[model samples]
Target: MSEHHTLYAAFAERIDAVLSALELEGALPPGTSRANVSVEPPRDPSHGDLATNAAMVLAKPAATNPRSLAEKIVEHLSRDPLIESAQIAGPGFINLRLARSTWTDELAAIAALGGDYGKSAMGEGRRVNIEYVSANPTGPMHMGHCRGAVVGDALASLLEFAGHAVTREYYVNDAGGQVDTLARSVHLRYREALGEDVGAIPDGFYPGAYLVPVGEAAAQEFGDRYRSAPEAEWLPVFRAFAVERMMAIIRADLQLLGIAHDVFSSEAALQAAGKPEAAEAWLRAHDLVYDGVLEAPKGKEPPDDWEATELPLFRSTRFGDDQDRPIRKSDGKWTYFGADLAYHMQKAESADELIDIWGADHAGTVKRIKAAVAALSEGQGEPIPFDVKLVQMVQLLRNGEPAKMSKRSGNFVTIADMVDEVGKDVVRFSMLTRKPEAQMDFDFAKVVEESKDNPVFYVQYAHARIRSILRKGADENFAPSAEHLGLLGEDDLALVKRAAQFPREVEMAARTREPHRIAFYLADLAAELHAFWNLGNADQQKRFIVAQDANLSGARLFLAAQIGQVIRNGLALLGVEAVEEL
Candidate 1:
């Protein structure tokens, strides 16, 4: 009942104690690092309940063969009452089978912990700032941005559950040429709203009909004041209004998928505060920035028109980049890289670690930004940890054909549209069914199917089935009781063992910074639950509610309830709902 108490953690400590005793006995060298030793579930469940490579990893350090070390470790491990058996497998791997009471005790722990079952203290309350879905303020949220958004949001929740202070951030790229185009697009809509015959939307302007509402609002607010004005007179005013409206649309779309960021950092605001100038000055002082000219293009046939122009460049080549990167353009305006460098420098000021979830198209720019962060942070005497995760694009399909574009957004399918067709839970869970960096297809037909092939449906059905059984037991005047848990058999204990893996899976996913692993784990756990449920179909006695045996029924229901709790805990980390009825 202590904080962060888990079955796997307990066994891990036991293994460490055994190793420490060997160190004291001079069986292993003193001060040897045990960092590489790992205790996890074996690949084949039939081998044992828990497997460790302790002997395999420590054999060389102890001046012994793996089999010798394995035998010694097993001799000590066999003495523990909780271990039913300790056997050495191929290549000196030691697998331990736990007493039936161990799984029963873990089930009790799950019930006691409830929603907090899988939470961990691995992060130790470190501050982590995660920036994601920083789509341009020029349009609505689309399928292109969906994958990174879900990945980043789920990772933030996962880290928080692992005991980190997390800040979910969205960077607004408002100070860019794209917003100018958006402003012009809204102007056409504004004129159309005022009964002006604004012909076809120009090729360079945003052609989405979504901007009509923003145009209508502008018309109502200004009342023809900027209708006939020159380009300069109305560009800035309309740009600000359009950017604000676009951000509102983006937020609403994100809300459809159950996503909300804690902070929305503005690129314009960062530039207005002169952070870029400050960053340049600091880099210059450290000789990390110098006046330089870049080489011509890298291909076999370089551009004949390529010319060298002197500009302020970051010494990215010094930090593993292929070449020095320009921070500003020939016109004295800051390039995207320049603004991003300053943005990351500012983020490092408040966070112990920083993470950016970007689309795979941005992969080429990652090295330069990493170099900038390393140079800037190290120059300040404290280097902050930074990670950039690139998520591949999701191709939307309908009946094996490419999905149609949204009339509302004009170019791509909007997130809202996707969520409307298939509910938010389906979209969120589907996005996470695959690794973030691997390309995936969001087939509308396959995702919404109710069959077991759909992972979301399969996982949700497991929780619903358990809830239904509990409800039926309630109607028959039966309640779950832990007092008779000893009556549960091996099949019941196997399910309990699978459920106990939730805490370990949570820590592993958090450590790898991969939330999709949680989805994979949940799918496996659901399969285990379904397999257990099938036992009742084969035999009447294996059913959860036995007509004449209240003690056995109560124990079964107790086990079922804890399994449901574990599923709910896992789904909560992925921000997916655990529906009682699906």
Candidate 2:
């Protein structure tokens, strides 16, 4: 095991020993496991440094006052060489103050590990699949899809960094009603381009001018032959042409934001092209396929002509869904869920874990989809691990006023449009500064501002400042020899200590499947370095790369260089850029 892991284990053992002693003395309840006990720094540095709730949890069961139990635990804990003091605080919490040497050791560990300081083995080589930006091929991707794309991409990067085998996937919704609308839109444009006055787009048909070029392409390829062709004669050609074009555009937009998928599973191919009869075979084998009539959905109704007809149903309710869902519509065509089920089943062939990133609007659809996968994997060894994360909407603003809907797109703001306004680095980092489930506001005016509130600029400035110091040190013949690292002073040691926590942050984010932790960690580390720098400004002797003291200056420069490496590594996991001299 790594030294950091060993240190944590030792710390955990000490806590367990204290818990055991309390139990043996009849000071606490039996069967209380110390495995969940945690030792972390207190929010207030003056409140005895580190605190634990162990005594508070054991008080009532031990028939003793919490503070009394805390006092006993502290008496037992103060013997450790690493701890300088221990005390009982408010509500019987045990607070600990570690000797300064402990923090100094942490700094040394950071220097030793360099960029690999925070790596963890929590994942144990498990495989995970992350699917995101599964937008339909009907049009260009908009701002609504941007947040999820960034979140999913960064999350996948975080997972991989934490040692999980991750596959990034994009589900293409090309076989459904939406794509048909796109095809029809392109057909109209095609006819329009062929000198036919198609007039304004027909009702139920897409009217966006984006399709005009698609229509023109078709006209140039077929030479007006499709103008008078039957709907069936040209529908396939139109559908193929439009979906391919739309996917191309979507790919370009994702690239603009620095995202690329490892797999692009096409719904159309899953349905009719590859592995024909796959969905039907799996459904029948599981007894999930049946003929039944669904109750008319409440608060909504299909056309009056929509009659209750016997159609294939999937017994989704068996797995906690509210209602059994339809696999085939009344028209004998596969429902969207049918295609989705087949796609997930295909996923099982290559992955052991599956995660889908969706919009909050799909909250109502989570259960049935999970149920289908559960049923498919029922008796085939272990159940496949499936999870869905919903990315909430993004509200944009400029100059404290809500930005008008994207002016050029004439619809929702496109991801490409946002990338054009602000570079990809700012967009990626700012979007991930908050949890994916929380609604976030991205202010165009503030992200580029040169202040602490703008994390992108703050982090980049820290890196640039570090570079300047190193260059100055090099020019003055202050060589950063490994010998200097041992003499790191308090402020320099504290900065390295903070930088060493990057691996831990990566592990936490990946194990919880939350990438926002990386953004928060980088910001906090930057703040720590900035604080250390400000302190130096007041004390000329302590300034980084002090020209008169070569040994001390070289050691501090090494610490700062390590800090820059950590910042770059952390930002890279979030898919954000790290500039050396911004």
Candidate 3:
């Protein structure tokens, strides 16, 4: 009774119905569940259009051999109108070849849906919060924050396409000690701006000249009022002013890469609201924290002030962490982990699931945070799902040499500088070329190349070639229609099979939370398009536009249009553009 129009889902439903009837007929065994049944495309397309391991997976549970179960399932599958043939393959796998008309109908469906071709309702509008690019508000965004921002944005877009209500969030670390250092650095610049002799930036202070503008602004506003004040008097004022300006620079830098977070949760605001104390009180009520002293740190050198003094610690050992984590330092101030726990507790109130994308350096913090969330959500409605993805570093190379430094950012390569060198689309597409956990080399000369090695260019060229074909038709209303679709041949039908995989790819990418798969899929789809176009070079009859046969040409052109549509949709999810011309 469901109105899901996905082709794979339709076949899955039929397969389930066939299995249920066999169960009711008392042929195999009663209580044989079909929960693990999966009707997906086969590993080898030469064998069949679709394959299922239902028989193989269910045989042990049904108390029968796999071959016997496969034969029974195929007997029922062959009776379906859409199936051309069904055969049992190795180890009781049922391979089915759907009718050619099924492929043709799918082409028509793509035309009807256009850019919305591969969207799915599998998420059922569940609330998911994705936190990414929580760079400290002390400076401009650098290349270090690029990968996480792009991946997190693409993942959020993919989830939304799959019917999830996703919130893209950014956590502001304004309450940390780093911001205090930033404030002191700005004050030094403030004195310099007021015509005072400030020598080289001292140790433990930020050396970047990007804060000069903040200092000039501060000096102009207050005019030496806070310049001679004590650290305590000017610390709060400087922290607020510098952090606000730094965040503005960061937002502008992010906009260059086509990213904007929906929520900017401030740690300082959380402290002001007394959330951290309330969260700790709840943990104490549950006995998840205790006053404990630690032994010498294992597998690492202890800090200089390491002592056995008693301090409040969370019992993370009970939840899988290697050791209990201290929530308060010897100075009686909350540690970073304590604030993080309260932040996550705040997140759980609005999100059904949470995901954080972090740099590779934060690998050690993952376990304790997971434990904190597990302890906090004990009595909540349905424990929230939490995942942390670690994104590896990107080594910048310029023609096999280390890339030159950026002047705009003062210390590191800025996102704005990268965007200026290579356009936003190229930056986004290149960042997703590899898995997030693998270190990648981003070569400036190689990324902008017009060769097949550059996936973004290759995919965009495929779309442009198709657009050129349709524009040559000379009809203002020229669009891919289902009319004359039966004129397609075996070669054309092969292209249709590739197109049919779009819906499957989209659903899989969304379910796995890996939008990089979409990038890989588009590359494969582009290769297929290139191959199909090359077939006409050897045989004029294979050309998409036949001057002597308009009907057949219309059919081929329709297929090309549908392919271009899917490429556009995939690019949209990655926040890239699909150009109409090379």
Candidate 4:
């Protein structure tokens, strides 16, 4: 792979070198921490191309005033051929204006690197296990799981682009009561398949017609053997069969949205292997677990049936949980927390880092699970970085009102149905238009609208328009050439500057674990491209294709091609298609 040196990264190195030279010259103290020094675009673009706080950050440690230090730094910085000028702004900040050749060189780099333009090495190949859309294997995926699914998948891609070895995973909750209920529901359908009336699905049972096929499949394979057996004999058989069939359905739904997990861990299988028991034994030896009685429930109206019972408890409160949590119930079965802790420990064994994407309803459980991982890390003598990102619910709407539910999933709109209606690109991109912690509405009518108001459309349209311009140039016998790139002026470099931000944006987004930043950046870049294209409307000489001047037109075409490549690269990270034509 070719190494990509982004404009921002290149300049950051230059600033660091300048600082190092200052230290050697005895103008500053030795071994001063540069951790806080940063290079970024000036908030006001009119100030300069790039801004850094190296002087301000190092001033106190060097025993000098910031302005005095900045002047010394700028003296060395001004000597670099790539730097046109360096000036000290307000107390200590340094702003730099790059030589025009610098941007032209970056544009040349963009052309040479093509799709690899914004790729970074920030992650340095660490293994990251990201679990998302682990909705119970109960039914088809619904809108409730849609946001986190897209967010997690996009983050995984962003990390990979930033040079991380990422594993996409899904946790199957097949051991819980939900799967047991699913088994009972499928049993009713099995009876119906075997010619029983099986009237309306009773309360507490799944009512979706999607399970009818699972029941028919079961009836075909098992005949009438377990059909008439006791609940004990049939529950296990039906549960396994139902879970397998439901997982197939979930996989199909995820595939429709361009998502596939590298691993699907089963809770039942984890229990069968006694992983939870091993986790409990280790925690007990480490004093992280003990036998205790939990206090009665605390509330404005406490439960009348609340009772205290001795159980194996985890010392979660020591790590910031409101109270210690129970690892097992009075009946000897592991509680959900016990199983989840074991699952995370299993994940930590192989991965350098762990991330879980869950719904907002799971927010209350975050602290305990984090405490478990912290305890496990303490026992192993190595810290395991764990983060749980909660995605707020998305309300599905048609036009302006709440959308109708799918008959297939019973109460919620299935992911398959949404993708079928709007498209995979629209569904995936719409899910990431807002921050995951903030609630959002997915309006069917608004998302599919073909206008600037729709972000996906706006960005895709930009790529499409660039292709159209290239095609027109080809038809007019004009080929894009870097030979006359010097013919391009300031208005054109503004677009180059916007496109150049992609690498910096990618690194920042990956560091923050927010893929939406890529989407936001692409939207702004598209706006810049569109604005630049509009300049041709008022003045014939400003148009991308100047019939009288092929050299200028060729240079402009080359610029447009590189901008299109950036749009494609950003959309690829979000898993959205960049259409060549509308």
lDDT of 1 by residue, 87-143 (tens): 999999999999988988888888888999989998999999999999999888999
Better of 2 and 4 by TM-score: 4
- Regions of candidate 1 where Cα sits further than 4 Å from its true position: 298-305
lDDT of 3: 0.90
Task: List where candidate 2 sits over 4 angstroms from the true fold.
Answer: 1-10, 13-33, 48-105, 108-112, 191-203, 216-227, 273-289, 299-306, 404-408, 479-490
Write down the worst ten-residue block by lDDT for model 3. Answer: 473-482
Name the lDDT of candidate 1. 0.93
- For all predicted structures, in order, the TM-scores are 0.97, 0.87, 0.96, 0.98
Clashes of 3: 0
> TM-score ranking from best to worst?
4, 1, 3, 2
Which sections of candidate 4 miss by over 4 Å? 299-302
Q: What are the clashing pairs of model 2?
A: 118-503
User: Taking the tens digit of each residue's C-alpha lDDT, what string does model 3 give over 1-582?
Assistant: 122367888899999888888889776577777778898989888999999999999998778899998999999999999999999998899999999899999998888788788888888889999999999998899999999999999999999988899999999999989999999999999999999999888999998879888999999988999879999999999999998999999999999998999999999999999998988898998899888897777758887877788988999988778889988888887899999999999999999999999999999999999989977876576677899999999999999899988886667898988999989999999998899999999999999999998998999999999999899864634455568988899889988888888878889999999999999999999998899889999888898887787788888889998999989999999999999998
Is 3 or 4 the stronger prediction by TM-score?
4
Q: State each model's CA lDDT, in order.
A: 0.93, 0.81, 0.90, 0.93
lDDT of 2 by residue, 543-574 (tens): 88777888888778877877888888888887
User: What's the number of clashes in each of the models?
Assistant: 0, 1, 0, 0
